[model samples]
Target: MSTEILEQEIALLRQENASLKQQIAASIAELNTTIAKLEQEISEHKQTEVVLKASQAELLAIFNAIQDVILILDFEGRYLKIAPSSAPSLYKPPVELLGKTMHEVLPAAFADYFLDGVHKVLKTRQIEKLEYSLPVGDREIWFEATVAPMSENTVVCVARDISDRQQIEAQLRHQTKDLEQTLQELKRTQAQMLQAEKMSSLGQLVAGVAHEINNPVNFIHGNLSHLEAHIQDLLHIIHLYPQQSLETEISDLDAEIDLEYIKDDLPKILSSMKVGTQRIRQIVLSLRNFSRMDEADFKAVDIHEGIDSTLMILQYRLKEKSERPAIQVVKNYGTLPLIECYPGQLNQVFMNILANAIDVLEQRIESKDAPLPTITISTSLVAEGWVKIAIADNGGGMPEDVQKKVFNPFFTTKPVGKGTGMGMSISYQIVTEKHRGKLECCSIVGEGTEFVIEIPIQQ
Candidate 1:
């Protein structure tokens, strides 16, 4: 019994051992194939990692080459990275900036706003723009900054400065203003020259006529007393004729006297001679006033004298009565310090303004039934260094549009042959440029017009 059991056990063991050997060989083959596949996959993964690292290095190089200032902040708003393109001189390498809070590395004044902008982008995950200024050293730099969000609580900020453009714009504005002022001054000078030319021509004409007329006027004036004396002697001789003619020889006195008409006409002839003499005297006086030879020199002069002389020259015009206007002249002179100026030029200014005032008054009165026309002149010492002269007229005032162009050269509101349109403009130049003073005008439509001139007092 033992032998049979042993033989069966041995055969079973042999069969099981052979089967186990085949299973072990198959398992070993499967394990080897699986390990080879895993090793290949590991090698491929390592190659892909190397390629990715190479691409990242290339990207970093490109980023560093740019000139713009770039900063990278960590999750907590600390400076984690910086590129050379941004803040080349202001910051060092990214390693230096690493692990430092933005505020700590940079001053609080500069970093506060920068960090705030960066955090805002990080929190909102959106691009934020800011424009501000900072003092780089001594000069101010204006910057425009763009903050953008990166991966997971990281932000990138870029900044650029644009101060030169602003400065150029400011200079352009100043040049424009200066050009406009220069143009205005040129116009004023031209107007003044034109006025001076006209006045000089008129003065020459008046002087020539005055000189020519003076001879006849003097001859008539010289003989007037003799004519009166001759009339008295004739009257006396006639009175004695009644007593002496009947007895003594009547030597043709009646024939010499033209007794029929002379008795009545002689008195009228004498009266006419007196009236003519007076008229000639008035004309001579007018000529003198027109010339204004007394105050023609440049010196410290009372403006009132110019005004008075101008008024006297224009007395005939003032006396003229029109159905429309009864022009009245008024002088409201105040104690004024004398001003250094050319008296003849100032007198021309007064004459031009006064004449214009009269014309405007006439127009106003003709247009409607308004108040009586009045031209008023006033003067006063405005301050220690200033003297104010005002000429106001109750005349047809200028409109806004017309007033704007009133000072423009060749602008005229009067009819042709009546005005040259350079009067007020010349006055302005004389008072402002030549005299170193200011001249301004105020007017309201249908109300009145007033011109004010301010000049410095003479030393």
Candidate 2:
């Protein structure tokens, strides 16, 4: 019995030993699982840290690469932080401005401007933008700033320098102004050229017409004296013949035809024809003198003869028209020596002035019931071998403003299409530039106007 009991005890001990071994294995397995999980968690944590570090580096690089100045300010305008990019733009080091108020670090005007933007952004919770210029050293620096609320009491400011842009804009403005002035000058030159061409063509036409008419008028005038004498001699021979010398039939025919009336009227008719031919001849001569096509170069000319020719050419206009009364011309001539000048151009100047005077006088007649229009012309020899010609009108004169621009090309007081606006301008050029003379106008609004022309006696 003792042996059997001992065997059972041994069996129980073996079973217990097996159970202990199993439990040991299970505990080892569980410890291995827990260790693996902890290792995995540690590995993940390390990877996350690396990613965070890289993100931080990238953010720093972006911040440093920014060109604009970045600043953080509190509600009271105190600088909270400044980006590294602002180092070049700041008045001092970023470290020095980090905790200081804008008023302490910047000028008063700049501080106030920045503070106002900050306050506005904080109150409105909206972005604020402004442009300002500051004189830095010897140069002016322009900046455009944008402020936005970063928090309830903090604002972010981004300012960019705009000096180069401002300079470019100013340069563009100056170029535009220069271009405009050049364009205006080109237009003026074009107008002057066109006027010159027109005058040249007109001169040629006048010269041709005068040449064609002169021959016919001279021939007719030369023949009229001989024709008149022949008619008188024939009439005297008839009167000397006796009535009884004729046959009876001839005597009856002469009595029937009123021979006495024909004898008296034929001589008078011939004399009238002679006078008309003389008048026509004078007019043709005046036309030739006025044209002066043969005398283009500078030559000694009678100024009074030129004036008379111009007057003769314009005589028809001076006569009484149905719309207005006749224009009265009072010529105050002075004894003067001959002058050397361009006769054709000088005549053109005279024509322009006289025609303009006539136009003004006619306008006055149409607008007002005033006295008869009168043009007074006076000539005198001034000192220094100069001649002065004063042509005045008793009509409404121009204002000061009009007188100032009267010689400018394409400037006129007449209605469009009625005046080419080039007459006075060309006249001015002829008197001043072509002849090396002076032309001036003196006018009073209601007292009429006078134009004074001064020219040297010799070229």
Candidate 2 lDDT, 234-345, residue by residue in tens? 5655664685655664566567655676577667656766766677778778878887989979999989898888877776667677888899999998988999999988
Q: Give the TM-score (vs. native) of candidate 1.
A: 0.47
lDDT of 1 by residue, 1-459 (tens): 699999999999999999999999999999999999999999999999999899888877776665566777776668766666345434445666778986776668778877778778877888999877766666777767788888877888776665676688789999999999999999798767695657654664465455545655776676678667557757766677678454343346556655555557657666766766776676566555545577655588667766775675666556547465457888899987666877777776777778778778766645456777888888888867898889999877988898887776567898886666777777787888878888888999888899888888863
**What is the TM-score of candidate 2?**
0.52
Computed on alpha carbons, the lDDT of every model, listed in order, comes to 0.73, 0.81
RMSD of 1: 16.1
> Candidate 2 regions off by >4 Å?
1-246, 366-369
Model 2 Cα displacement at 158 (Å)? Answer: 37
Worst 10 residues of 1 by lDDT: 244-253
On lDDT, the candidate that comes out on top is 2
Give the true-structure RMSD of model 2.
Answer: 23.1
List candidate 1 stretches off by more than 4 Å.
1-297, 322-326, 365-368
